[model samples]
Target: MSKSSVYSWRIDPVLKQDLEQAARTEQTSIAQLLEQIVQDWLYKKSSPDDEEVQQRLHEAASQTFGAFRSRDSKGSEKVRERVRAKLRQKRATQRPD
Candidate 1:
């Protein structure tokens, strides 16, 4: 578990009402909504200036590939081999060379 800090602050009632409505519509508590909003804001603020956009952007493909691996031996290699096998099967069916 990670440590968290609590702080007190005030916002306009109108804004708070809007946030509450949005939170309700999203089926989440206001606290979780606010936490997620703050986390998202902080992440965007910390990101590169060139990354400021409404569309969600992912990291470089090479950087993300093989990020999650199984507990088994040669996990990444196994995944690659499976993908290759599927491609080979598809091509064999399609071209029959």
Candidate 2:
């Protein structure tokens, strides 16, 4: 255990009530809850290059990558043909100038 110093500041009544409720739910004092919250925030702020963060980001990207599908499995191969067909349809719908 380390020596702790007193810190105080004013906050909104509603926010203070919410914090008190959270502390009660966690079975902790408001000061201890605040200390844990501040410690967690500081840990995250200080570890931008942490491996756990990188692994989470990689997992998210891997899950989302190529998740969307077209009716045709070979859609990538037909992009140019699709664009040409759409352009022809648009031109036919337009009045000639």
Candidate 3:
């Protein structure tokens, strides 16, 4: 197991109430919700602008081939294999020439 650090902070009551309500709606604790929001904010703040290139590629591939509509297991397996192969090829092509 990894060690963890604990930090404490304060926020306005109105803001805290809103966050608490959202956390309840999401079925999570206020601490967890705050942690998630902070982490997301920090990630967006720290990430490089060009990181969206890879993100967009991944989203495009997922949107194109992520879901299988087939009920047949064999057909699904074939589709998975084909999509996996295409993804591999695409990744290979994306590598430095």
Candidate 4:
């Protein structure tokens, strides 16, 4: 004869309440519900199609963020305002020239 194994985990109060409500509605135990979720997760994780999508997402993120680039702040807000005002004045003068 073989023996069954048991495991334990701590869940948040709100999550536990929600699970209990769902289990009651489905006429199932929390353990069974959790087992079904884990089985589905394992199946999806082992699928090769999901792995390719995950890799593409990682590559896209790296490209969008400029691949680990650092930005240096050469001018403060006051300096930026002054520079912008000067540029605007220069453009206005050139328009009349």
TM-score of each: 0.48, 0.49, 0.44, 0.46
> Which candidate gets the maximum TM-score versus the true structure?
2
How do the residues 56-87 of candidate 1 rate in per-residue lDDT, one tens digit apiece?
A: 35454445556554578787658888999999
Candidate 4, superposed: residue stretches over 4 Å from native = 1-3, 50-97
Ranking by lDDT: 2, 3, 4, 1
lDDT of 4 by residue, 1-97 (tens): 2529888889999999999998898899988887888889999878768779899899988777743333645455367887889999999989965
Best candidate per lDDT, number?
Answer: 2
Residue lDDT tens for model 3, 1-97: 3529888788899988898899999999987887889989999889866778789888888877756557676885487789999999999999997
- Which of candidates 2 and 3 is the stronger one according to lDDT? 2
Off by over 4 Å in 3: 1-3, 50-97
Angstrom error of the Cα, residue 17, model 2: value is 0.3
C-alpha lDDT (0 to 100) for residue 83 of candidate 2: 100
Better by TM-score, candidate 3 or 1 = 1
Minimal lDDT window, size 10, model 3: 64-73
lDDT to native, each model: 0.81, 0.91, 0.84, 0.82
**Which residue runs does candidate 1 get wrong by more than 4 Å?**
1-4, 51-97
